[model samples]
Target: MLTLRDYDNSDIEALLALANNKLVSRFLVYTFPYPYTRADAEWWISAGVKAEGDVTKVIEYNGQFAGSVGIARKTGWRDHLAEIGYWLGEPYWGNGIATQAVQQMTDYAFSDLKLQKLYALILAPNTVSMRVVEKCEYELEGVLKREVFKDGQYYDVHRFAKVLKI
Candidate 1:
């Protein structure tokens, strides 16, 4: 079974081990450090996990740390919206873990958090993620050309969003 829960110190080792991979970090934002060191994991557990206006959680699969999922609520005029992001350990990729985690987060955002909309900004090259969001019923809002510069190159960004019906 897969679950989303609070981050704890026990996740440090597994987080570092699963996160320290180029393939996993390739499509992620630049802030998600490639090396993913012990200090990074410590900081994440100590500080990053508790960011204000953000709901971050550890993805647990059968009692093991599988990955992470989170949503950052927009401030001020866009307070009803939040940006959702998630990533699964490379070993757990093809098992539909990400899709399930995202679905859970989306439900949490709309029901628990009272969010009106949730969106994901996926790099254009990440077709897998696009498919994931598509499966979750997120509509393609638009595309921003060359909006992201990562790994010393530029890439387009695909914007996908799902809005609450009520």
Candidate 2:
């Protein structure tokens, strides 16, 4: 079973253990940092975890901190839209954990957050993540050409979205 919970001090060790991997960091935005450290987890638990509005949850499987999933609401003209993101520990990959987490989070965002739509920006090389969102019913909105530069190279970003039924 999988669950999403608010981050707490107890999660620090497992958070660092999973996030420090280069393979996991490579697909994430630069904000996630390459060599995730205790300082980063501390800051995240201290400040990054949203106390209100949208939602950011630590992904847990069988009572263990496994990864993170969150929805970030847009401001200004796009207030009804939210950007969702997630990552699972490398060992947990290929087990459909991300897909389940995304589905559960999407339902929460629509029902509780009152979001009208949810979207994700996936790097071109991250076909795995793309498939995950697709499996959760997100449709491709479009592709941004060479939208990001990471690890000394540029990559296109694929945009995927799902509109809330309400």
Runs off by more than 4 Å, candidate 2: 51-54
Which ten-residue region of model 2 has the weakest summed lDDT? 46-55
Per-residue lDDT of 45-112 in model 1, one digit per residue for the tens?
A: 99998999999999999889999999999999999999999898898988888999999999999999
Flag regions of model 1 displaced more than 4 Å: none
Q: TM-score of predicted model 1?
A: 0.98
Can you list the residue pairs that collide in candidate 1? none
**Error of model 1, residue 43, in angstroms:** 0.4
Worst 10 residues of 1 by lDDT: 28-37
CA RMSD (A), model 2? 1.2
Measured over all alpha carbons after superposition, the RMSD of each candidate to the real structure, in angstroms, is 0.6, 1.2
lDDT of 2 by residue, 15-133 (tens): 99999999999989888997898999899888888645558899999888889999988888899889999999998999999999999999998888788999999999999999999
